[model samples]
Target: MCEHMRPASAFWSFRENISPSALSVTTDGKHTVVGTQNGLIFLNSRGRPLWFNKKIRKVADVSVSTKSGKIAVGSSQKVLYLVNLKGEPIWHRELDSSVIAVSISSRGNLIVVGTDLGKLILFDGKGKKKWEVHLSNSDFPVNSVDITSDGEFILAGTDYSHLYLYDSNGSVLWSKETGSAVLKTCISSNGDYLGYLTSDCKFSFCVKNSRMLWENTFDSQPLWIDMAQTADFVSIGESSNKVNLYNKSGRKVWGFANESSRMGVMASGGGNVILGNKGGIFNYSLEPYLKRLLTGCKRSIIKATEENLDVTESRKIYDVASKNFSNANFSQFLINIHKARNLAREARVIESDSVPSERRLERNEVEEDPIVPQENTEDEMMAKLVQLAEMREKGILSEEEFIMAKSKLLRI
Candidate 1:
């Protein structure tokens, strides 16, 4: 068996008074922009807070330019602000509906905003309105938006369960019905792949042709998702206060948990990840994890071969790992090596038990699903109902909204 190794830990982290509603990491991983319930924050690569702005109230989304570090923020108050690195607003625009999402190009030359009014608007770096398109009715607002690094492509998801891809000029390239409300969406840096999460708790990845590569469903609803530059890695934050990393094939590499709720996550092109919430901003690097995994896999294969155990499957896996390593695809190399090590271990067990070749166990991949919270009891449900009623009385919910929510809560 291979020796155990230490796991990755946060490189740097710090807390704020408010939980982050959204997170955006630059392609180079040098900067991060966070949208909080009551303000916006900018952090450096070392996790030092550079500046904070309380003027951008109830920030729903944030995006940072990959090359220029320009920030575009969307707020629930129906305002979109383009801010400079020093946290000063360069320009602010008010829309007829709530601004829900924003994405800025690499050079900070283009910006896109998705609104509660179901409109997708594009603006130049100087805040000029380039074009606008209404993808759905007001009831089906655009919930997420993403733009390629070069600003040549844009992707948007809606509450109506639709996903649309558009060129730089706002022409629709294609549209697909996702069959569930798309909570969030992201495009790869080169626009080759797209990732999205649905209200049904399913995370999916697809190619430019709209072919779904793979998908996984979680019991706990996801709060945020971001894809790496080439879509080689995907990261997700969940309401369960956990962050997970998955590879292109939908295999989870690891999960990080914390005491506080994790509401936002971003995966940088350089294989770095950042997670944010009321607890703090946590940064992590995948290098350590992948290195240990690769080392352990090599050891396991050697051990199995020395013990004269069946090494056919393990050899094949190792061959693939060699190819990935030759190509400098470290992520895929480590993943394949991890799989090979598991197979090698299984071979040892089968050989020691003298299991017949035909009856050899086929190892099944085990997935660590999120822990589901306990269902509320009658009294607890009653208390929640009372709280909902109080919120409605305070005008937090319209009559139609309140009735709909109550019905869903009561299963009536």
Candidate 2:
């Protein structure tokens, strides 16, 4: 599982006095909500605290609604609290037993709670009980539960080595008996894929139309597991002090090992992962190449600015790139960084030949009187026009910038 390990660095990390008991992240990787013995914590992508509430005693589990940004908190105190992103409580319920697991739908319209009393309960967003299913008569607690994004399906794993899938109406679709107690379960956003872990050190994935897509046996029991919205990525935190990520093909994408135990692991659609234990919560990016590109773009912009180049557009694009990078939106970050780099190159070209230090053009003057090469062959002029077109196509230049660059290149 560690064979394809790639180097990963945390963009940010946060620590609390108590080890995080539960972790949940949104699909965009913008918000991460953590639960500890002290309370519930809402964190931004940069590991900065948005809000914190210490009223919930001994939080056992937490879940976040990806679409609506609602949070559901389950505590060992036999209480469930529904809170907003601002940490203000919307509702609270005292259950018959301690809550072992909890999950909220993507839209925050439904919720499912797993209790130590062997009861799996479903509730509407408004705190109305929809239904409850008794897993076993012998108090085999439900260890883990997950619901589809639309709240149409629910999956639950129990201490009795039983796994059950049910419809929103509380009718069981199917159930399986694992070799051992099921520790964790995850469902893809569309309910088309399922991933689970059993106490037997087995990790399994199955598709909707299939029995099981693949299974892997680990040397140690995996503590927590999560999947991306599209089912393209899965991640696990193990008792072995390692966190491993797997792609849809069941291939290991990367592995991160640390001295401290991983309390939980979560995967987001934006190629971001968060794993933590007693030490702290750590944010890691799967696409480190984009990070390097962003760094290079920043460097290029700095060099262009130092040469007294009119890099106003480049700086604006670079700021957007930095923000996207901080938010773990690697795809948008890549696009913006490339635009910034292209603009920086063009600025360097204009500054190198057009303006001397003493007679540098004002910002408005530069925009009004676009730089035009004093001497250029027909081929050179065509090449410059093509470059401007490329910049326009890539969103490096605005419509006005494109028109101005074109007019300057062809002397129109």
Best by lDDT: 2
Quality of model 1 by C-alpha lDDT:
0.73
Candidate 2's displacement at residue 242, Å, is 2.3
Give me candidate 1's TM-score against the actual structure.
0.68
lDDT of 2 by residue, 315-402 (tens): 9999998998887675466467657866877777667764322122222123211222122555334434544554455565667767
TM-score of each: 0.68, 0.69
lDDT of 1 by residue, 102-166 (tens): 99988999999999878999999998999999996555789999999889999999999999999
- Candidate with best TM-score: 2
Question: Mind sharing the TM-score for model 2?
Answer: 0.69
lDDT of each: 0.73, 0.75
Clashes of each: 0, 0
C-alpha-based local distance difference test score of model 2: 0.75
In model 2, the Cα lDDT at residue 359 comes to: 21
Error of 2 at 227 (Å): 0.7
